[model samples]
Target: MTTGQRIAAKRRELDLSQEGLGEALGVSRQSIYKWESDSSLPDVDKLVALSRLFHVSVGWLLGVEEDQEEHISNDLSPAQLKLVEEILSRYQQSSQLTAEQQERVSELVEQKVRESRSPRHRRLRYGAACLALLLVLLAGRSLFARLKELDRQYTDLANSVGNITYSVNSQIGSITSRVEEILKSQNSLVADYATNIQSADLASNTVTFSVRVVPKTYTEGLEILLHADTGDGLVDVPAVPGPGQEFSGQITCPLTDSITLSAVLVDQGTRQTQLLGNYSSLYGSSLPAVGISLLESALLNIPRGEDGLFHVRENYGFLTGLSASVSAVNEDIGQSQVKQVQLGLFRNRALLFWLEPCSRPDNHHGFEKAEQWFHLPSVELDLQEGDELVFAALVTDQYGRQIVTPSLPASRVEGDEITWFSTSFDFPSEPDGWGLAG
Candidate 1:
C-alpha cells in the first residue's frame, strides 16, 4: 500500500473521522483527503504523529514496513500502547462532532470507496507536490540519522549486559560457588558477600536488592553496596552487616539496577576502606532476560572510572572452541590495533586450555575481516564444554607511538544453559601501565 493508503487505513481503524484526524494532525480536511487519494504526502512530523496515535511505527504508517517493533522507545511499556488504544476507542464511542462540523469535513473517502479511482494529478499544482516530496526526502534523512543514534545507544548497552535475571542469577551463583569450593580458594581476608537482586513488575517501576555481607579483618563500620546508574545516575544502596554489627549477615535495600555488586569493609580505628568484592560490568539498554533464557547471548559494558582510566579485572568462563566473535567500539579504527584475542579455559579456577586468534601481517586490526572466528585446538589436552574460561579482546591504538590499554574480562552465554560468560571491553587509550593477563 502507498503511504497515504496506510495512513487512511489506520485513521479508519482508529474510528477517527477525517475532520478529527485533520484536527489531530493540524491539517485541513482537504489535506487528509489528498493524502488518502494519493495526490500528496503528509510531512514527516504528521507521519510520526499518526504512527504514535495508531500505536504503529512511522515506517509502517508510511508503508515502509508492514510492522516494525524496533523503534526509539522499544523499551517503553506495552501497557502504555494498550492504554492509548483503549482511550481512543472510548473517545470514538462518546465523541460528538457538530452537524455543521461534520458537513465541513470533505467526503473524499466516499469518492475513493465508491469510484475506487486514484486522484488525478493536477498539472498546475505539480510544483507544490514536488515541494512536498522534497520535504519528505529531507525528513527521511533525519529519520535515518535518528536510527543510527539508536543503534549506537543499544549496541553500547548490549556490550555491558551482566549475569542473569532471578533464576539465572541464582543458578550462576550456585555454580560459581561450587567451582570456588572445588578450587579450595583461600578464604578472603578483606571482604566477602553474596549478592541477590529483585524488581517489581513493569507497572510498579521499582527494583529491590538484597546482599549478604561478611567481614573478616576490618570489622568496624563494615558495609556492602549494590547499586548502579539505574537509568538516572549512580545510586548507592548502603547495605549494612546482619546482626551484632560484627561484619557478617544479610543486607537489604530497595534500590535500582543490579549494578557493580561490591563488598567494602571499613576499619573502625582508622576509617580505612578495602574493596573486598567487585563484580561490576555494563548492562544492555533493555533489562536482561529473566533467567537461563539468556544463555548463548553476549554482553559488554565500558563503565568509565573517575580517573579516566579503564580499570583491569580478571574473569572466568567456559568455551567449546565454537564461533567466538568479540565486539567493541573502535575509537580510532585507522590507528587502532587489535593485537590479541585470548580465551583462557580452566577447571576449578586452574588454567587448562588457552587459545588465541591467529595473526596475519598488516592485518593486526581485523575490524573489516571477512570472518571473526578464532580456534585453539590442543592435541594433548582434552576440553569439556562447561570448563571455566575468560575471554579478553585486547585492542590498542598505535598512532606514531603505541599505547597499551587496560585489560577486562569477556564472556558469552552457552546455548543449552551452560558455558556462558560475559564479554570483555576496554577503553581505547595508551595506558601508562597495561597489565594484560597472560
Candidate 2:
C-alpha cells in the first residue's frame, strides 16, 4: 500500500482523530488531512513522531517494509487482555479518540498488566494501587531524563575523540614532512664531492678530468689525482687547482686500447686515497648518432603502411598538424657533447621550414644526449600524386662537426598504387636557412 494509506490505516487502528494527531504533532488539522490524502507528505520529524505515537516502525509507515505489528498481547493476562479489548471497543464505538485520551488508555493498559504481575500490588486496595501507579509514572519520567542526558554525554565524547584524532593526524603529517626534508639534506651532505671526465680525445690520446669539492674547508692538505689503467699498470696524474672549488687534470695515454679512468682525492698526511668517479672509454661512440621519425597524426585519420610511410591520397589537403621526434646521442669522452639540434621540413626536395637550434642538450655542463619533439603548425598544402614530405635533423657536437640524419618520407597514394618519393636531400647552407617563401 502507499504511504498515505498506511498512515491512515495506522491512525484508524489507534482510533485517533485527524485533529488529535495534528495536535500531538503540533501541526494544523489540515496538515493531517493532507498527509492522509497523500496530497502532501509529513516532514521527517513528523514521521518519526507518528512512528513513536503509533508504536510502529518508520520503515513500515513509509511502505519501505511490510507492516508488522508488535504482538504485546501474547504476554498479557486474561484480565489485562479483556481490559484492552474493552478499551479498543469503546474507542471504536465513539469512532475516534483525542491524542491525550489515547495516551492515557495506553498507559492504563500497561499499568494494569504491571499491577497484575506484581505479587505485592495484587493484594493492594484501590487507594494503594493509585499511589503505586503515580510512583511508577514518576520513575519512568526520571529514567527517560537520565537516558537523554547519557545520549548527550556520548555525543560530546565522540566529538572530542574525533577532534583529538584529527589533531594527532595533522601533527604526524607535519612531523613526517619535516623528517623527509631532514633526510634529504643529510643525503646531499653525504654526497658533497663530485667528479667527472670532461673530455677524452682519441687523436691526441689526452683525457681531461673535472673535480668539485663542495666543502672548500675540507680541501686543505688534499691532493686530487687521476688514476688511469692503460692495459699496463695504474698511472697517477696530479690535478692542478682551478678557480673556486674546481680542479682539472689531463693525462696523455694510449686510448686505442680500452682504458679505465678514475678521479681520486689523496690525503697528503696519511697517503690515503678516496675514489670519486670512474669512466670507461667504451661507454659511447666518438661520432654522435642522430635520427628523425614522424609520429602518428591523430587528426589526419591516416594509417601508416608496412613500409613505414604515411599513405595520403593525391590532391589531398594537408590541413592537419604534424609532429616529428628528433634524437641525438654522443656519449663519447671527448666529442660526446651535443651543442644544438636543427630540424627541417621538406616538400618535393625544397625546404618548407627550418628551425635552427630546435633543441639543446640538458644543462648538466657535460651532458651528451638530447631528444625533442617538433610540432608543425597546421597548414594548407596541395599535395600532388608525386609529392613527398620529409623530416630531417642536423646534430652538431662540441667540435663544430655536424651530422645529418637520413630523410623520413611520407608517400602519396592513387587508387591501389603507391608512389614512393626520394628520401635523399641536402640541407640548405644559407645563414637564415629556409622558410615557406622558398
Which is the leading candidate under TM-score? 2
lDDT of each candidate versus the true structure: 0.37, 0.46
Q: What is candidate 2's lDDT per residue for 1-438, written digit by digit as tens?
A: 555556655664454555566788999755675565443567666766776687765556665556444211123346544644454344324433456645664575467556646664442123223533443454445344433443454344333433333333223223323543464355422234455556667445455555554433445766667666665467777877666655565655544224555556566654434444334323223434343333212113344455645544321111110112212122335334456666665665466666433343233232122245454544434444455555555555565544444232234334334443322233332222334222
Q: Best candidate, lDDT-wise? A: 2
For model 1 the local lDDT of residue 359 reads 39
Lowest lDDT sum, 10 consecutive residues, model 2, at 314-323
Q: Candidate 1: TM-score? A: 0.21
Q: Which residue ranges in model 1 land beyond 4 Å of their true spot?
A: 1-192, 201-206, 218-232, 244-258, 269-438
